[model samples]
Target: MFDTEREIIESKIRLCLDCGKCTVVCPVAQHDPEFNPRLIAQRRLSQNSHSPQDETIWQCISCYMCVERCNYYVKFPEFIHGLRAEALAEGAQLQCTHGGALQALQHMMAREDLLQDRLSWLPQDIELSEQSDTIFFVGCAPYFDIVFSDLEVNTLKGVEGALRLLNRAQIPFNILANERCCGRDLLLQGDREGFLALAKANMQEFARYGVKKIITNCPECHYTLKVDYPNVLGDTGIQVMHLTEVIAPLVQSGELSLGELEKRATYHDPCTLGRCSRIFDEPRQILRAVTGLDVVEMEQSREKALCCGASPWVYCGAVNRQIQDQRLTQATATGADILVTTCPKCQIHLRCAQKSRDGKIPQVEIQDLAFLAARSLDIGGESVG
Candidate 1:
């Protein structure tokens, strides 16, 4: 299976034209000149050996920038994942930033008998149905808070924000008590077997609940379930949507009322949500509906937006920090008091950068779009922004 996957990925790699557009748009290549997508393709094509210890292979960040920028339609990120899978199969150790604790947690979730208190973060006031066709798939928020608690980022707030919006819209949704990680990190980290196991287990759980539609606040989860799951498990007979996709229409139709927020804010497009899924307008639409709130554009807006640096919770270093700092600088340049993004990981990564700054760069408030939208509804006590 691994050999067949590698062959398929290499077939895509063979289409690289060496135009250097991918390298120009890559956030990692911008900071580390040594990291070049064109060169990586060339080297892979020239070499017949698969070296799992190749450090450069793991630095791609899986941002999909190369694939987006490729004129020949070469899927570079998929190629990198294939290479990483080969490496992992060769017993090559990965340098996971969280000391592999998060990976271990994901592996633990694959157990069929494992019981998780995943809904502990759900507010008591939030309305949920015992048997609903729609499930609000809260992806890995419980684990993210524990993993990134040191950064003081309340990852669970994104979940709360999502729930608040659902409640305000009066949308009947169900929460899965045995919800598992969407296996996005595992898939990106080249743990194909692990990712498939989690996907299969989660699908079984979803089947048991008779889920027809899934609404997720996490872009990674949205992408994995909407795109990856179908590829791996065939037709899932389920519809997947990002929270913005669901809420934007409600805001526009006057089904949801948003209070005026007197602040200027810029939106950061998560790669999965924007470039991969082409969900560029829903977020902006929702933001514009908030009266008195000004939406500013960063130089790199929409498809051209830069990554938040960290991905798959691994290979974070000086290069990733530089990318984050550059993105924050751009956000500050917009003169927006707040920077809002649709992905929880984007909020966490940007907030981590904001916290570590040495008081030199102007600090912009980092917020999740769902959180800000929830605040605008005035359903919660304090403004998340």
Candidate 2:
């Protein structure tokens, strides 16, 4: 629907100083030495066979580490995104994880005629208001419940965790029974058409429900809805907020009281939430609100945080596991018994790596930030992080 990625990349390419800073900071390059960002730029601009379809393009996790570290402001991840769209037009495809089941799930939600049974995970007691103009968007966790069953992760639990907090804080919001996937993965994989289709459909849903604002627990959904939707679909009057952004103030004001949790925890900043969206503090603030929970930091935190290595959900290989192991090891080094994250995908990827390693890495429990916060809340019942 737009011009080719070359023009944008070319403008930035000219500014590139052939600096190896991108390569030095790249998590993928750290694990796999051959996949260099500086080299990737040279090869991509050259006439040699290292084309967009080459592994060089797909190898990027799009963590934006290079762009974060680059003095020249070269958006290598955005370059890959554009090149992927171009490559995909020429029959190139990424080796998607889960046998492309996750991608297939996204495509199914793009259908205008389809009605998704998406609200089965909603808790019985959480209050919902039919007249409320706000929506607590539950993105892809219900389907992930079935698809990522092997990991034994209940992503819906994370959603429930967020919902319960909203209820406790007396924030009235409705859940979209037919909410579609955010189509972030589709856009990343170069299926721009699919991404656009879903974005339009989701906007239509927002209009139909009179949605004035959206709050979500998933960082990917938050980033896509808060940033991507408006950029692609124009300003649709709907504003988006991550659950942490909405709840952190309540915790700080003493409106929402959380019980104590005696555990040592280290936070993993999801790339989309921390670096991409600059929501580094809210999650940490919420974690700190839990009384007696010792929050430790990894060596790489905030702008320099290591990626979850599962962005866009493509090319899950040894390199991804290596990065996951590195992250898990970092948590271990911090002497934290639990590794907390706000992103469900990060939890899944790290948990999968832990599963694969079979006690090779340190055995730190992976927990969701909102869930951990929710666990601390007990107006009547009990919970855990």
Candidate 3:
């Protein structure tokens, strides 16, 4: 499902005409000159038959803005994912601090105890359904790792929220504790072997559950499951959904009440969430429902929103710091006191960017829509943001 290397991808590049329309609309380009999708596509075509270019290719956040803006309809994430795979084949991997994150991901996957312990945030007695039509898969992130302590709680809340919505709507879902990491990090880092392993594990677990649909809050997980899984796992009869997509209907029907929120805020579209999956409205609709909250739109909004600069991995020192400053400045310029997003990765990176700003510029509060929605609903919850 992730493969994009074919005559068609090359054909799209040839037709690109170097229009630069994609660059003008790229979210990453707003904050990062190093991450121009158009330039990357041009470079891929000029390469000596798949020779790896600079590490910047790996820096793409899998946001689909480039595709949306490009007249060629080039598949940005598939191309980048393929490029990273080829780079590793050429003996180049993640550059800078991103390499450290790669190591951490590998370590967590290798240690089952760590994986099990990662979900310590839930109660031991909390009931988890073993048989239902749908299952909620929560992707691993720093916030879920740090705050939940027990991975079960953070994962459970997602399931709980889904279950609550489902219960009210009479929709039921099963919980799969055996689901492993979606291997998106490895895929982004070009660890094809690791990605395949995790994919196989997740596929086997999904098979055991015998479900036809899967829902997850994490865009990374949603992307991996919906796009990549089918390539390796065949037709598992599963439809992957973001929690926002699943909950939107419930919210629309008044199953999930939108409570009072009195603040000015803007939304950051997660590359994996909005760009990769074309999910731009569900989160926005939720935000809109909040009473008295002003939802400010950034100059680069929706399909053209800027990247948070923390995915494929973080750059170190001045490079990453500078990118963060640029994003914060844009967010603050919206005249919003808070910035909301759906992806945990976006939340973490933006918050880090916020902290790095440290009052030098007008600082805006960073938060995930889940936490914000939870706040709106008076549902007790915590966020890494």
**Cα TM-score per model:** 0.95, 0.95, 0.82
Cα displacement (Å) at residue 306, model 3: 1.0
lDDT of 2 at 117: 73
RMSD per candidate (Å) reads 1.8, 2.0, 4.2
Q: Pick the candidate with the highest lDDT.
A: 1
List candidate 2 segments past 4 Å from native.
Answer: 6-11, 47-52, 379-385
Candidate 1, run of 10 with poorest lDDT: 1-10
- Candidate 1 ranges with C-alpha deviation above 4 Å: 1-7, 51-53, 381-385
Poorest lDDT segment (10 consecutive residues) of candidate 3: 148-157
lDDT of 3 by residue, 1-385 (tens): 4453662364366677788887777655665677677788777778465544566775565656678877768766667777777777778745646347555665456443433544455434334566776876756752344543432223334434444444444556666655677887777666777787788777777776787888777788888899777765676678988878877877788776767788999998877787677888988888887888899988677777767766555334454556567677888888997888766666656666655566675567766676666666555243323
lDDT on C-alpha atoms for all candidate structures? 0.85, 0.83, 0.67
**After best superposition, candidate 2 residue 142: deviation in angstroms?**
0.9
Instruction: Tell me which residue pairs clash in candidate 1.
Output: none
Could you tell me how far off, in angstroms, the CA of residue 184 lies in candidate 3 after the best superposition?
Answer: 1.5
